[model samples]
Target: MKYIKEFEKKMNLGSDNQLANGHVEQASIPKENEGSVQTYVQLLKPERFYMFLEILIYCIVGHFIGYLIAPILKNYFYNNLEWY
Candidate 1:
């Protein structure tokens, strides 16, 4: 029984060491925006600036209207309120 327990413990330790090594290897590679600075900066160009801004503004406006209406409708419905 003691030998079996020791053998299992050794296998568990080996698996844990392998997982740690795998994580270390994964961390050594460049990730997302951390890799290249210029590539991310180039994404914001003059030609696409207005287009991006326009889409952003539209999304913001839609969100704002939805925010304002959602609460009011929710409250009205919960309170069973209606008007002619």
Candidate 2:
């Protein structure tokens, strides 16, 4: 029993009974940012700008495709259809 207790102590398995001998280290807490609101506002500005750019690109591409397909369809209908 004595040998088992000594073995447990050597393996640090008696942690529940042992008192801490060294200085206890603590985790450092992060400080709150005072300009966090302003930072978020700044982040949103670029997001809005990118969203506007994406919408503009979609509009331009859609109009360009429509312009290309319109003439081809018009010519096909004019040649193939017999109008009374």
Candidate 3:
């Protein structure tokens, strides 16, 4: 029990690095899961929200392109003559 608490405290202290402009580094506090249902949510600060959205859009577009290309290529080969 004692060792676990120390480990957790060290992990929670991860954002204490210094910035070049003398700002204390900080990040979102972790949230706890709801009982039994296994669902939880984090309220993102604005900067984090913007970064999240940017990454989300990139992932969505990348997956969409992959999904579109998969069927088109499959059909192109399936429809082509074996000699070609």
Candidate 4:
């Protein structure tokens, strides 16, 4: 458990550094004030896209696991426990 926690801490720090670097790089790039669409496009860097993908995958996997486990838990509680 301690090793898992340590690994998670290091991964969080690495991601933080990646995000800080992305922000710094984004700030260094100049954008035109022509329209909101163009500005939004400028903000969509590749690293941000991958980060978004990672979040999407995590969400999908988490929901799938929850869906798979829900019925078993429901059945167990329905048969083995009583609620008032």
Best by TM-score: 4
TM-score of 3: 0.39
Q: List per-candidate RMSD values in Å.
A: 13.5, 16.4, 11.9, 12.6
What TM-scores do the predictions have? 0.36, 0.44, 0.39, 0.47
- Give one digit per residue, the lDDT tens place, for model 3 in 1-84: 677556656655324453434344653333453342323232324677889999999999999999999999989988885963
Question: Distance from true position, residue 2, model 3, in Å?
Answer: 45
What TM-score does candidate 4 reach?
0.47
Model 3, position 25: C-alpha lDDT score: 65
Order the candidate numbers by TM-score, best to worst: 4, 2, 3, 1
Per-residue CA lDDT of model 4 for 1-84, tens digit only, reads 677557657656334224522343223233466555666576567888899999999999999999999999999999999888
Q: Which stretches of candidate 3 lie over 4 Å from their true place?
A: 1-22, 26-45, 79-84
Q: What is the C-alpha lDDT of each candidate?
A: 0.63, 0.67, 0.62, 0.68
Model 2: lDDT to the true structure = 0.67
* Model 2: lowest-lDDT 10 consecutive positions: 22-31
Q: In model 3, state the lDDT of residue 60.
A: 100
Error of 2 at 76 (Å): 0.6
